[model samples]
Target chain A: MAALSPPYLLFLGDSDNPLSIKIARGLAHWRPELCIGETGGELSLGLKKMTPAQGARAGAKTFIVGLANGGGYFEPSWVGPIIAAIEAGMDIASGMHQKLSDHKEIRQAAQKHNVSLHDIRHTAAAPPLGTGVPRSGKRLLTVGTDCSVGKMYTALAIEKAMKQERLDVDFRATGQTGIFIAGGGIPVDAVIADFIAGAVEQLSPPADPGHWDVIEGQGSLFNPAFAGVSLGLLHGAQADILVMCHEAGRTQVKDMPGFPVPTLKDCIDTNLHLARLTNPAVKLGAIALNCRVLGAERADKHCAALSEQFAVPCFDPLLHGAGALAESLAGKEE
Target chain B: MAALSPPYLLFLGDSDNPLSIKIARGLAHWRPELCIGETGGELSLGLKKMTPAQGARAGAKTFIVGLANGGGYFEPSWVGPIIAAIEAGMDIASGMHQKLSDHKEIRQAAQKHNVSLHDIRHTAAAPPLGTGVPRSGKRLLTVGTDCSVGKMYTALAIEKAMKQERLDVDFRATGQTGIFIAGGGIPVDAVIADFIAGAVEQLSPPADPGHWDVIEGQGSLFNPAFAGVSLGLLHGAQADILVMCHEAGRTQVKDMPGFPVPTLKDCIDTNLHLARLTNPAVKLGAIALNCRVLGAERADKHCAALSEQFAVPCFDPLLHGAGALAESLAGKEE
Candidate 1:
């Protein structure tokens, strides 16, 4: 028998959530033969984890995981912790209350090997430079839940961070396409404008390898924007990475994968990780957040939990500062 | 008679365009005397100029003016030059090309004062920031024909320019009350959110004088949001001024004093100027054009004519740049 690729996904939600199913299916499609896991443990015992899983379906293990992204602790709340421990360096997003606060059994299991234990309930410190394109330098892109949420917030944070890093970065970057959540239907002007811009970009040659990163959000695979148009923007900008940022705890996903859209953020942590993942040629990067909006104390508690959970540093932009976060990310080079 | 306050506004629209009439009725229900535009140039001018005589009867426009706006340039043979003549500060905004440009006498008449020229034909040049905000230090709040025609563009331009000037401005300043351009109906959540947020701000002591601005765009007055909560948002964000942005030409605002909410590019200048004259204190600001999206070169000529005609700046934000235009507005202080 041929060797298999290790799993990198743990999908949540029920059948009613077509989006969750779509996500799982998307990963599987990219690399069939990937193992689907309803249950998981130290899959990499006494061995190093696989580096990249390209078409490896070869031996990847995907978890259907547990339900209750909204469930509490002491009540079989081992999903987040278990995934965290096994993933080790992997980033795991969690939902609901009481993360595995040192449960004897879970801790014992994690301690035996080099696995890590964490709980990813709170949202990302803020979004990271999701538009994965690394060669262009760190950039930001996001789709808002409304005109609010954290799109502008995170974008502004990154701008500040870039300034601190003293990088010759210009945050004047635009998706050329924007939308406002309303019943009147998608703003056709925005759609047309964005599409034309994207098409023009793809038809042009890349100025440099991974010249830019294009982060996008909102709409679903069914929506022309999420699928049809977004690609154009990413192509136009030569985005190196793709990031998606959203609140979790019980957030919903709505899409059919491979609509041709690139990387997306469903939770905060993954959103940050996405920044670094783009162009693996450079630093994958770290995360930034807001303590005031999220409540300083609460954010601190969550940041600690998430750091352990994802094995990546988590921060709040409003408190430690975007510049501070940037410094931390520099040290996270893979 | 008591001196009238400048808090009144007049909205004009047909089944196809109703913003004008809505603002009028809204004011009539409150302090009717301060509402409507009666005495000024439009009503006082000849046949082409018109206004809400009905609103006048209610004693709203004790200090009124006539300024009609619409979208005639969008029809068959209209072009940009003509649009320019109007938005350049064309007087009244209505009628077909046969009246303004085609008809020599009417074209000459359109050249008269008190009108603006230009249409929402092409984009502006310099962004509309310092110029758009009336006061360089003030923030922004706006509404457009719809969500698509450069609303956010204008806002962002203004924000960008302001930052360049070193103003420490905040946005959604109140985090609640925001300007809304009611269309068919408002969503309940939007209204509630605005209302709750507005209330919270109001309850709090006067803020420490923020340098930020709050702007909102409404979908509709009939929206569930309007009925329950958003109504308050509309009320809270409504400053002393209420200017309508329209695309107008002789063909658009037909039959004089026609329905407001002009759809062409040429009429914007005339519309804004008239709105201003109706209440000098809250006199209208200016107009931005979208020539490429609306008409042709003739409209541009007309828009330029209107600008010469009214002596008020009539421009296209995309082409002219929102900042350059907004910068000029610095001189218009009371």
Candidate 2:
């Protein structure tokens, strides 16, 4: 439960998956001090590889985090470098669907080194089913235009800004990495199909009326490959307010060819409609744009333009703090 | 794989669940010939039950089918009557979330008696994830007003009607009861959340152009309790045509109070919208009314009125056939 130490070794396994790349990029941009070096095998996908030796040279009290997103890449064969990382007296953290702790060799190595294995997807207790009763709380859910479009990052940013303003708010994580960062939360996608909503319900139980649950979203309604999870999260969140998250200038849904990218309007409308099925009074609170791909000038111009056009507060929370969003949420309900 | 030779001895095991009542009702109404007797221990719900002796005197070839829902109902202590039933040479069938074969005593009893154990929710192959690519063939998914509203029955009826008409059709089940009846199909609810859609996608793969996949639906979008699974099945089915299933005169979502019953129009519209997210051209082909509560004449009149109201074919497949709905699907496109 202790905070993961700094000088972390990020194991990309081959640096092949888009998810791995995203996580690497996110760490490089956000918490570079925690990151020492990256490791990848020969068949890595996105960028070139770096050796395990290079990855571990910085310091010894480091942690190894597997960062693959594709299927079948987390097998036993990939455990050698992970074992080496463990034997080097570094603890392990993994967001991979395949938990590193489940592998015999990895667990043995971690035990020998007396370091812990953190499996983020592992739930502490079985969550109860959703009761469908209306709970009293202000919940803000992040809905995205596509998968891996910064729903988690936006939520984290918003929570950071809210805390800075001394607000009573909590970030409810639903995915693996978010779970890891948050220390404890449901891995919503790993639950049985019927209980996804129930798990979410239990996570953000009723509290004070002013208490805000900033829920992490998954997938997207526009992403054909993962819309089910998206809809599940949307309905389950039962949000009083929603934040539309999008990567600016994306032309298509990820991995799904010929499927057109959803515009901001479309994303907002779809999210509102779906969320309203459960929470009829749900409203779009703001737009947290992921302008990571855009230039500073262009991002600011588009954010301002979108704010004017939609008549809603629009900002990249990482660039422009979520203080404006929090302020707008207080005053803007028209 | 042979058809279960059944003079069924229904084991209710202190039947305290509504799902137990449903499975009993379904068998009593649809497969009366197969059902010989019903047994419930002390804590049974609903109507009174007959003894196991009364159940088996009619015939020797009998199958003891455990009819219960929820957890921990299939414990070792509850295995006595099941063991007796197995000793009496009845092959066991269970639709409980718990598999009877997994119990030590039950497995030993079955082995000693040399009787087969049929776990309806047992999936044979590791089904592949959905490709999200355009696949060939026609698929018709049942979207429902709520859970246990006869979505599975309607799908079975439609497939029956289609097959009777000498059409190339397949009925793909998505829940325990449907899987029991169909002999083989994915148990969508039993599947892990991430793989629910993929299991469905594998169940109804691309077939001949004119071949029809009549996919049984689960849960309902309006039902907050189980909507996650419902939406997953909807997106996964990738149906070109959809049939709306509803129980007549139901005024609210089952088990979840304060949630109003969705109107036929609302159900159709919601289904079409959600289905369109995956299958853009998806159409609500017909309505399969579950008018089990109504008198024959009343059922007929309501069916006729609802058909007129929705401008779509509507019928209780048990009262009339799925013929009209099938016929309407073939002719009506507007």
lDDT of each: 0.32, 0.74
TM-score of chain A of each: 0.37, 0.76
lDDT, residue B235, candidate 1: 31
The sequence of per-residue lDDT tens digits that candidate 1 reaches over residues B58-131 is: 33322211122454332332233233333333232221222334445435645663433211111112111101
TM-scores for the candidates: 0.25, 0.82
Highest-DockQ candidate:
2
Cα-based lDDT at residue B326, candidate 2: 70
CAPRI docking class of candidate 2:
medium
TM-score of 1: 0.25
| Residue A283 Cα positional deviation in candidate 2, in Å, after optimal superposition | 1.1
DockQ value for model 1? 0.01
lDDT of 1: 0.32
User: Poorest 10 consecutive residues of model 1 chain B by lDDT?
Assistant: B124-133
